[model samples]
Target: MSANEVFLVAMLIIFSLPWLVWRLCRTDYFAPLVVVQIVMGILLGPGVLGRWFPDYHAWVFAPPVVQALNGLALWAVMLFVMIAGTELDLGQAWRHRRESGITAGLALGVPLLLGCAAAGVLLHLPGWVGEAAQGWQFVLGIGMACAVTALPILILLMEKLQLLRQPLGQRILRYASLDDIAVWGLLALILMDWNRVGRQALFLAGFALAAWGFRRLMVRLPEADRWHVALIWLALCGFTADWAGLHYMVGAFLAGAVLEAAWFDQARLDQLRHHVLLVLMPVFFLSTGLRTGWSVGGGEVFAAAALLLGATVAGKLLGVHLAGRVLGWPACEAPIIGWLLQTKALIMIIFANILLDRQIITSASFTALLLMAVASTMLTTPMVAPRLANRRAP
Candidate 1:
């Protein structure tokens, strides 16, 4: 076949595989959607087909197209945030916020500190990527990766356990939402620091705080569909962060915090998610898989990926167990909550991709981290859900 035809066909399959897998699995394999999408991309891209058909990844998931696909990812991320907001029952979150926050606190804090310490070590190793990875940037990348959670997977689990509307679920959801926002803001600052793309630590913090104040003042103007307001604000937020040399996701996330503060509705949130979930988000995933570059092969990369997998297992479970009691959760449920909350695949992959593309980290490092995230999600999901099946709310 002609090279252009090869490229066109590869693009078509990579983009369509997620929905196709969903259909093929009869939607049974829906929970681990990100993993499915990524694996399929690997099969189709440089991992397998791309090795033979090099024209595909270059033509399809290239800069211009990936940039366009990012808009959809941004939209999904925003809608996901809004849904998180609607799911937040203030009474429940406030009642449990102290403990809920405590849980979030431990989960994030440990990763931040440990990842920072681990950075020096992870940096010395060869990266899956070709770039010259540094000390603090290595630290920042791992720390941010440590702090993230995958909301799509979390939502699916909530639905499966019938925990979407329950008091426990509401509390967990609110805190998770808050945790996500905090992590993104911190990550933006970290990325800026690593790349020297913009201001350093103090400046980014001040900018974010000032921006928060400005946002609080502006969002006070209520709109008919707060979700739509959120969509516009999300785009603007991401654009702002991008302008500031931070990843656009940073801006989208902050805009979401403002949206949550507005008191949105479940129905509207659902509508927003439906709008972005199918084609846009799937395209984003495909693009991410293209970047994942399963072609990376080496012993050091494999070892580091294994370590990350172990950390995801031990660190997340321990973090959850530590904070479960304060939230009024029983022993039986605490472990489940810990596992499910730590499942990090899609969002981590997206965040990791930004760092890789910017040359802040090596592709191999990204690959290991991707492997870690996928392993964590798989390990956590089955352990958490089935155990809590009996305790599931109606």
Candidate 2:
């Protein structure tokens, strides 16, 4: 088949298979359609599909086809990340600063320390650290990956559980929002190149001046034009950041972070986020899967995943539980909040992807991190549902 035909075939598989499994199998209770899409991506990757059906995999994901998909995936994730940044509600977090700070601090810090230890263990072994990474970069990258709370995914899960507008749900959002900022900040640090320090500094200074003008212009524009301008801003920031030695994803997040959520209609913002997820993000997931490898051995990769999963869940819970004690939150609230905050699907994957792209972590490490992310996300609903049900039953 021609490259176009094969690309279409790949696209068909990317969209259709996940939906079929999600619908026919009725996995929504434990695994949402997004989760299934990620899992499906893994299965269709070189590790599984290529291993089992090399010729077919090669034909379908030919160089041209893969390139086309990657182009789509890059734009898709940038839009998604920008939406996440735009939706951060830092005003709310500031209003509840004391509580938000405490929870976000522990929720991120504890897992980070534990994950660093886990990284230390991996450092002793081969095939885990990337070739270009310094020791500290590898350790901190893994640590932050554990600490991530996928704010977007958390919002989705809370919406699913019918808690999105509840007081508790809003509280969770505040905590996650602060952590999201910290996560991105740390990512920028990890991706820092001493050789390009001057360039990065210049990018930040220029970005600040540009952002001020951009915001001034945005508020004056009609809503219809704001959307077009936002995309232009996204493209420009992404390009400038990539050129400055920071990853384009970092720039994407910053571009959105500076914008006010109130500038856009809430419903419209939600629709934009939803449509991006529905239409574009599946390609990103598949591209992510293609990057996963098990050169360190499948057993070792799974073991590393399990290790990271334990550290992530345990550290998040322990940290939140500690915060509950200090903040005088009810006993039951800690576990439910902990499980919910531990959701790490899209954001963690994005974090690990940047690390891999920068060569701060190997594909083997990426595979392990990917597996850990999927498992942690799947655990969120199941773990939180029973606790929520019991709380409401009385």
TM-score of each: 0.80, 0.99
Model 2: worst 10 consecutive residues (lDDT sum): 1-10
lDDT of each residue in 32-142, candidate 1, tens digit only: 565676666545545556677677556655566666556555566655544543443445556667776798887766656665555557766554433644566667778
Give lDDT tens digits, candidate 2, residues 1-394: 7778889999999999999999999999889999999999999999999999999999988889899999999999999999999989898999889999999999999999999999999998999999999999999999999999998899899999999999999999999999999999999999989999999999999999999999999999998899999999999999999999999999999999988888889999999999999999999999999999989899999999999999999999999999999999988999999999999999999999999999999999999999999999999999999999998896
- What TM-score does candidate 2 get on C-alpha atoms? 0.99
The positional error of residue 189 in candidate 2, measured at the CA in angstroms, is 0.5
- Any runs in candidate 1 off by more than 4 Å, and if so which? 1-11, 26-31, 55-95, 111-120, 128-133, 193-228, 261-263, 294-300, 325-329, 390-394
Best by TM-score: 2
- For each candidate, the alpha-carbon lDDT, in order, equals 0.64, 0.95
Root-mean-square deviation per candidate: 4.2, 0.7
